[model samples]
Target: MPDPMKVIETHWNSTPVPIDAIIRDIGLPLSYEPMADNISGYIERTDGSYRIVVNSLHPETRQRFTAAHELGHYIYHRDLLGDGVGDNRAYRTEGTNRPNANIRPIHERQANSFAANVLMPRHRLTDVTDESTAALAVRFNVSQQAMAIRLGRAG
Candidate 1:
């Protein structure tokens, strides 16, 4: 199996802020335009560049998560898997899917985990005041569910 940590380390080293730096470092301005009917996000890697197409129709938080998730695919899994990586084809469960289901397919799960970790690294989220998921979410700019998962994984 490929080392997921190495993938994350590579992305971390290549980026200064990891999330936003990936855009500016490659000279791509962040555009939050609604993609046509089909496109979710796109990265033009020909010149080692990126252009993410987000659906402004969605909630701001949803779009932010999508952008971060797409960024995870770009940083960690794109070259390894080749083209068309920005397509969010992998399954995401609402409530019934087992928690592990969120992290089964190796690449997709890793990308999700990478996005979560990059956006909310341990060093940044170490405040750990009282263990409330909602509190942590406010601290990290992530969803309450994401904070809960990270806290669970940390233990």
Candidate 2:
């Protein structure tokens, strides 16, 4: 598979970052559905094709994050994935809440990091000065919390 970061770099021409295009460019099909409240999304390989499903009920911005996160899994954890990964409300898989692993699985952590990078790329954020998180989130079409997390990570 092509490097996820490379894919992002290739397709990331805007804030909110053409997420669906990036996912599709990586060769995965995308869909949205209403899911249980705590369920954000999941990625599964059925038959021969890979697919990413996001909760339609979630906010659109959040869904973009979720999709990017699943893309992260497709990139970093394909071998470890036995079937698929279901992310919970906090964007973590079940049984990944162990504090020792920083309260999330390494895969989950990596995916989350990847999602942040996809949405609010470090190169973009580094060019800004004195912008508020809320403003940046709006510009990036991501949640304030997510933007704050990305900013923190960038620093």
lDDT of 2 by residue, 51-142 (tens): 89998999988999999998888888777665677888788776322122222477788898888888887778886668888788899999
lDDT of each: 0.54, 0.80
The candidate scoring highest on TM-score is 2
Q: lDDT of model 2 at residue 34? A: 89
Compared with the true structure, the alpha-carbon lDDT of candidate 1 equals 0.54
TM-score of each: 0.61, 0.86
What range of 10 consecutive residues in model 1 has the weakest lDDT sum?
A: 93-102
Error of 2 at 104 (Å): 6.4
lDDT (Cα) of model 2? 0.80
Q: Name the candidate that leads on lDDT.
A: 2
Q: Which stretches of candidate 1 lie over 4 Å from their true place?
A: 1-18, 35-48, 89-104, 127-131, 153-155
